[model samples]
Target: MSALDRSAATPARVWLIWVALVVALAVPIAAAAASPLLAWRGPVYIAAGFAGIAALALQLVQPLLAGGHLPGLSAYRGRRLHRWVGALLVLAVVIHVAGLWITSPPDVVDALLFRSPTPFSNWGVIAMAAVFAVALLALLRRRLRIGPRLWRIVHMTLALVIVLGSIVHAVLIEGTMETMSKVALCALVFVATAKVVADLKGRAKRSASP
Candidate 1:
């Protein structure tokens, strides 16, 4: 796409993308809600799975949504939307983990403390730490006078960590994720990581050129 064309892509398209993602993410949640049988088996697993998916999708999409061409939209407004979405994502993670804790407090504690036998638990723990780090950076971002370049690097790194960890967790949990959907999501995450690395390298190359 030409620069002008890229710049002109409609914000409506981005809105539609976000709406579609919301519906996709909601399917598992709705399923959990509608199935009393799932609750009998232990609702926490399903609830946590839905919340994690919602948070992951929001984190992935918020940046694109903010950048999309929206008529008469101020920079401040776009950033405000980003912030709000981020806050909502944090809430989703909390709900996800809290549900897990309620269902199996000891197991949750074990996972956090690195005592869980499940290999995916290691990934989950790392991802949770990365999320906490990002949250801390966001909180202290202003007071610390964080520079744009440093913030970008840290944010991108932690985002990769989140995606990797979440994918590992999903792959290890056989029952929660549908086979095809899990594979597709993991492939997308892999591509996203590669794209971010390429973008960073390209920026470095340009900066180094005369």
Candidate 2:
């Protein structure tokens, strides 16, 4: 195939990917927005719950950007976006927790302390901590003078914890998110993370060889 032929298809592919991702991200939010549960909840509580959903949606996007799977984004731009999205993910968690705290300080305290009765609360808190850890690592990665292997290991370890914890946390809750959409989002996050992690592992292995 000529370069022109291959180049002609790239824009179309990029557009399709962007549209599919946007729809995937929007589905759960639409489902949650339609839920009857929100009718009785206060604004803060509703905002907090939706923030969690937003964060979950972010999980799928992060890995795609991190892996450079987004066709139109240059590597430099992709890395930059990954950083910004990572920051947003952290912000979303803060909003989720803060709004919940506003709604019920005691419950938030219990969850933070790992004393919450619900299994999902434990997972949520674990994921929240992992989110903060990843953010901190990113912030201090250069200052800490960590070795490349160690940094990747720590980052990947925390990434796995965040993904798995968030999955469990979302799955265990019965909330505004519709069942089908919630499950589908979780599945997409899992696949995207797995693909990126596997690719990273292979690259690491190849780099280690002569």
Candidate 3:
């Protein structure tokens, strides 16, 4: 194909990928909401579960934006959206935890204190801490005078922790999230994260080349 032809095709392909990602991320939340599992839960617990779901869906978006993989969005725009989405992700997490605390204070305390009997609670707590740390570091990046390389390294490392921990937390819990949709969302989260990490490594390699 000609250069122009390839260029024309690129946007279409990107949009297709974006659509797939949206569908992958949305279906699980929709299914979870419609599931019989949520019917018995109180509003507080339901809110907490949905907040967690929203956070997980946002996780998938973060990597795609960071990697500049979204269709028609410039890297600058992508990063801008990433920052906004990151803030929302933080909010969702807070809501998730706070709602749970309101409903069951002792469970929240046990999770926070690392005394929770459930393995999923441990993973959730770890992921929540990592998420908070990442947000704080990003907010203080300028004030802290962190160099670009160091910032990227630290950010990506924490990202991996958040991704893995959240996935494990979601998987281990027999909660409101429907099983198959939950699995699919978690899988896509991993894929998106891996793709971004790979893209960052490739860019670093290319920049280091002569």
Which should have the higher lDDT, number 1 or number 3? 3
Say which prediction, candidate 1 or candidate 2, comes out ahead on TM-score. Answer: 2
Task: Tally clashing residue pairs in candidate 3.
Answer: 0
> Candidate 2's residue-wise lDDT over 1-210, tens digit each?
223534665777879989999999999999999999999999999999999999999999999988888777777888899999999999999999999999999999999999999999999999999999999999999999988899989998899899999999999999999999999999999999999999999999999999
Candidate 2 — which residues are off by over 4 angstroms? 1-9
Q: What are the C-alpha RMSDs, in order, of all predicted structures?
A: 3.8, 2.7, 2.7
Candidate 3 on 3-25: residue-level lDDT in tens?
Answer: 35336657669679878987988
Which sections of candidate 1 miss by over 4 Å? Answer: 1-3, 6-39, 42-45, 63-78, 204-210
Evaluate residue 9 in candidate 2 and report its C-alpha lDDT on the 0 to 100 scale. 55
Give the poorly placed runs of model 3, Cα more than 4 Å off: 1-11
Best by TM-score: 2
User: If scored against the real structure, what TM-score would every candidate get?
Assistant: 0.76, 0.95, 0.93
Count of backbone collisions within predicted model 2? 0
Q: TM-score: which is higher, 1 or 3?
A: 3
TM-score of 3: 0.93
RMSD of 3: 2.7
Candidates' C-alpha lDDT: 0.68, 0.93, 0.90
Angstrom error at residue 206, model 2: 0.8
